[model samples]
Target: RDIAPSDVLAAREAGATGVVLEAGATNSHALILARSLGLPAVIAVAGLLSSVTDGDLIEVDGNSGEITIGETVPASAPVAAGRATPSATRSSAPPVTRTTDGRVVRLYANVGQTADVGVALAAGAEGVGVVRTEFLFLDEPPSEQDQYEVYREMADRLAGKPLVIRTLDAGGDKPLPYLPVAPEANPYLGLRGLRLSLAHTEVFRTQLRAILRAAVHGRIMLMYPMVTNAEEIALANEQLLAARTELAASGEEAGDVAVGAMIEVPAAALRAEALARHAAFLSVGTNDLAQYTLAADRNNAAVSYLYSQTHPAVLRLIQATVTGAHRRGRPVAICGEVAGDVDALPLLIGLDVDELSVAPHSLERVRAAIASLSYPECVARTEAHLRDV
Candidate 1:
């Protein structure tokens, strides 16, 4: 069965060595958490539950997606064949990567919790791109002070690196136990992200206020998810202003924070020009954008073949977003699974993406890929891909 991000965290705390999920997308929050915590995981394993029982002595190979069941296994057998073991002597990549043609690209880490901050820094991440804040509201909504402590600690640990904190993106695939969300036929398209925040102004304000307060500790950027139109950004800014005013009236100090928007919906990508006018920066959520653009449920196996970030339609949308944002002199970032994909690095770089926020474990690989490419070649490849479209 599918697991939640909080469940992944709890499993880590319980000292679990690995995770096996019957169903989950590779880019799902739970799996992302698993990677962040360094837990070996294999998902979408059919018959996983029906074939195993408690104390079956099953061996799981996350890299190969192979499971062996027996009374005992050879201790000398390698779990992942040919996989390089972590070595202390491994050279660390630079925080920022420059292509052979002198184009610079920033590599950031997508973290889920405060603990992931140190790991990101150690992995040579230039900054923390997007902090998934839903983890704090999984069990129950945290008080403003509680949220403040976590956000502040993350900023403090970053030690002046830019930390982009995304507000609570709950209500759809991720539902909070404490918040009542009416069941809908299509939760993905239902009230979620900014819509959910707008519907619950108090909760939204509390989060904005906490983020604002945390800004005083270090460089912080506030990003809102699922913003489909300029009006949504305007409405969100209204709440942000209200939070700032409330903080000032209470004599609570707040620092300057840049506001950004996540372009996940196709509509948002098409209107990136307008959205760029409202947001300070734009980050592409290719996972949702690909699924939404293709009308393929990412979590559904039957339609999985249809879901691709490289598809011409998806690539055009990303190009449009980058083009639109650049017109307004706003930076654009890719913070989805494709950002870390070595094969997709050329495409993104060719499309002129400014930053890539990937899982911490993928930092070195992505950096290497960026260093091996030529900006002019990437641009030619991108043009070739978009030629007939």
Candidate 2:
């Protein structure tokens, strides 16, 4: 029998923090559920069960398909030398993602918890890319005041470092039993992300109120996920304005905060200019974009071959997004697996993406890669279809 979303839910309910799936199950519903739950998972691992015995300590890195067993380990995960995390220890501040030719690229980290901030910062993350706020509601959502404190502490911990907080992005692959989430025929193409927020006004508003209140602590940025068009951005902003008004009436006001949109769906990416009109920034969530564009799930090992960021179509959309955002004076940051991908880096640089937000572990190598290559060469190689090396 194949695994289902319920299977992942059961694992989570049973307190399993991660999952290792067979090779063919990469794009399966179970994998989607694992990501939705923020549980670490390594997909399509060859001979996974045969290689492991019960009670053996195992670490699964979803970013890199590396599996480790036993307590003996290296001082750090694999990363290239030169301005690397360990090697960069001589400097007081983390180095920005920059090239050998004196070009600078901003690199941020995607964090789930507050402690993740320090680790990312230590690894040279310029800021926190995207914080999936859905985790705040996994075991019964927190009270508004409770969420405020959690968000406030995160800001305090960052201490002026930038933080991009994505509002609740539940539905489709992720459903909340505590909330009214009806089963759908095609969940991915159905309600989720920003769409879910607008549909569930109260839930969205409460999160906004908390985020707005917490904006006083750091360089906090509000991002709406899976936004498809200009209207959604506008409607979401209306709610935000009301939240601000409510806080004002109570004599406490949230400081200036920049609102942004996630360019994960094609509709948003295509009409980027329209969306940019209202958003202060645009971030591309390439994980969903790749799957949606290719019509193949990354978890489905059978068709996973079709899921590629290198495809010209995907690159075209990315190029279009960056061009549109820059035209409107808004910066675009890529916050997906592709952002951290070494092979995909040059193409991204060619496309002129403004920022890259990756997992903390990828910070060092990505920085090193940037330092190793000149931006002009990356662009020329990509343009001429020549080997980047």
Best by TM-score: 1
Query: Model 1, 196-216: lDDT tens per residue?
Result: 889999989999999999999
Top candidate by lDDT: 1
lDDT of 2 at 186: 81
Candidate 2 residue runs with Cα over 4 Å from true position: 1-19, 23-42, 46-53, 56-93, 385-389
- Evaluated at residue 20, the lDDT of candidate 2 is 76
Report model 1's TM-score to 2 decimal places.
Answer: 0.93
Could you list the CA RMSD of all candidates, in the order they appear?
3.3, 5.9
lDDT of 2 by residue, 79-187 (tens): 2221113343334544566777877889988765565566677777788888867654565766778888888888887788898999987776557654566777888
Q: Give the residue spans of candidate 1 off by over 4 A.
A: 70-92
